[model samples]
Target: MTNDDSKVGDIPGKRSLRPLGGVLAAMAVSLTGTRISVVALPWFVLVTTGSATQTGLVAFCEMAPYVVVKAFTGPLVDRIGPRAVSWTTDLASATAAAAVPLLHALDLLSLPLLLVLVALIGAARGPGDLAKEVIVPEAAERGRVPLERAMGLSGVIERLASTIGLAIGGSLVALLGPLTALAVNAGCFALGSVIIKLALPRSMGHTAEEASSPARKTEPGYWRQFGEGFTFLRGEPLLLTVIVMVGITNLLDAAITSVLVPVWARQSGNGATAIGLMGSVMGAAGVGGSLIAAVVAQRLRRRLVVLTGFLLAGAPRFLILSFDAPLGVVLAVFAVSGFGAGFVNPVLGAVFVERIPRPMLGRVNALGDSLSWAGIPLGGLIAGAAVTAVGLAPVLLACGIAYFLTTNLAGLRREWQEMERTGGQSVPEPSSKDDASRGNANLAT
Candidate 1:
């Protein structure tokens, strides 16, 4: 068998972890930075504006462009090469992120200015995040790791970032101030850009069309490429089902994190520290769960795991917070929830990578992710408005019920049965000639 197919323990020589390690490191810093901002930004807005609606508006501004730009950037990422796209966009995000604090310090930061800066950050970050995801299979191959395990490891990195970043961000926001956390966020973006540019092998993450069959010498236009992804995704019932379900849950999650939790903390007198502590508890437990998934997920039934995970991961946190629960009870519920949440992404990511052809990975993944995150921009906005009108308790109860219903009802769909199939592997070759020939019109290499 070829070395590429070798299992981790059975490799002929040393397995190189550099490629995977670099990617993980880059993911770690960037996600951690983002998480820190999650804590810092909302708090900053709430304290300054004293308006939950405005806080939600800021989140809407950031994520709206994130979803829109990401939906359309699939073609650019595929053609320009993910590696180049990753570093350059990260650099742009860094600059935009840095500008937030600089403008504030100069006493010139207005609401409009903040929104513009964050919108720019979101725009650059859309493709930056997509590029990082596009390279995961290549990183796994170079590391001689199983794709599922690699995805699990990626989840672990994400959770770890959430843990560390939240903890630090809370402390920074509490003691030094939000501006400090914002500065750190900018630094993390810069560091991630550097890692992607300098750490990985120069040959890595090149344009897929360049490495594909000679028929790819001719490439389709941008809109044509975008349509290909939309068409392929439209035909896949399982993927579409997954996307719809995930989109609902993502909206709920965004609401919970961006507005509900923050409002709860303030109302309960728990403040920013509690926000960090709760998130840290959950994230730390998630790290443990992701580690186990990395080891054993390949042997499990993915649909079952996913359903069970959602069962644990959803509803309870919202329900618990609906009442005047003590801090201990809240933390315990969040820990269990986080643990369940950890197993989800690895399996989902594996399912996505396995089913889609390599040549179509960029556009397909971008479309899939964008769809799954479609409701996020409105999540905080709705939550903020709901909390303002009806109060936190009723909104929490309602969201919890909605979360419960969405995940459970989704399991009834027959498309979920396809989750068990071993469809395609993340090999360099195309899954089928039809898939490979889709963009063979005028691709520039």
Candidate 2:
């Protein structure tokens, strides 16, 4: 069926609820598994080696693969279909996660081996994550959900996952050892993969061209398709600007979370649980922000929401850390910061879904996501060195100020204004005549 036809099935008031429920359920399971590993893995490294640098290195290794692999595989996801890509990669991640704990149990775990396993998981997960994102527009279409609401629901899902997952991760680590927690994580990934594969409607997987080109096939060559995606993104200025802005913010965020926060916790004498709790608090507050976005995001100016979110999210937590506030106060500050951040993704997601053509969704989404996340490893590295040199508090304060300035200042650019315009309108549904022409052209291939 056509996308317009897909939108017709939902009753106005209740339409977004069902598909959003499915998406949120899938995200909760998957992110819970990831969050558990986030806790368990670092704890394992720190306990085993007693080296902060080593722990940072492990994070770097994982993110390096994630960025590189995702950047290159966007076209593959577009060509092969997100459903198959998502399920297969999730299975691979589950296997990698399970291997870590099993090897540890056998007394065969080594640092290099652990890094390799995590890197593989990251690589697999990159495309898998992209696949899920690519499917959002389709899911929203099928559910007759407004694009903003669908995106807002995604933000809520992430926030809920972070809050619940961190809480559960900490508890699991305390009760069952890091290895056992990891095993549980593996199980969650497996279950999540199954749910996405089975629970989603078959029609939910259809691409923009699927209805018209049942027997037509694209060229089998991988590099050509990959090149096409890159080429398309290069020509799209508004999209490029969004990617760059997100990338800068991501870098700053990575530094804050991975490097500065740990140092701050150690200085404050609260230890790792405090770090986890800080994250949980932020996540909890983000839930409220995400709900607000879900309810009213479509009515507000999209760019203003994003800019405001940046202003609120970036500086406050850093200032809190710089002051060495008590645990409770720090948690509160994080909550405020997270609440601001919660609105960001939904706005950006809706913008992307509205502007990008469905035929190129996989590659473009993958490319944008990979580029935005590329700075994560570098941020960790820089934060580690900066803390080692300048001490943690001063660096954190500087980062907070810089983040506030950078984001707000960037909003003044003409490119950002163009992005706002591009995102404000709905994508027009293509005519059947256009679809038929594209199909005939495809059949000749």
- Candidate 1 lDDT, tens digit per residue, 1-445? 5442234422323466776888889999999999899889999899889997788789779988998999899988877678888899999999999998898899999999899999999999899999889888767766668777999999999889888887789889999999999999999999999998876665455433355656445667789888888888887898998899999999999999979999999999999888878987888999999999998887888889999899999999999999989999999999999999989999999888777765677898999999899888779879989998999999999999999999988987898888884543433332243244343322311
TM-score of each: 0.86, 0.87
Model 2 lDDT-worst window of ten: 4-13
The clash number for model 2 is 0
> TM-score for model 2?
0.87
**Backbone clashes in model 2, listed as residue pairs:** none
User: Which regions in candidate 1 have their CA more than 4 angstroms from the true location?
Assistant: 1-15, 43-55, 104-110, 207-214, 262-273, 384-394, 423-445
Maximum-TM-score candidate: 2
What are the C-alpha RMSDs, in order, of all predicted structures?
5.0, 4.4
Predicted structure with the largest lDDT when compared to the true one = 1
lDDT of 2 at 334: 84
How do the residues 8-27 of candidate 2 rate in per-residue lDDT, one tens digit apiece? 32332234444445556777
CA-lDDT, candidates in order: 0.84, 0.77
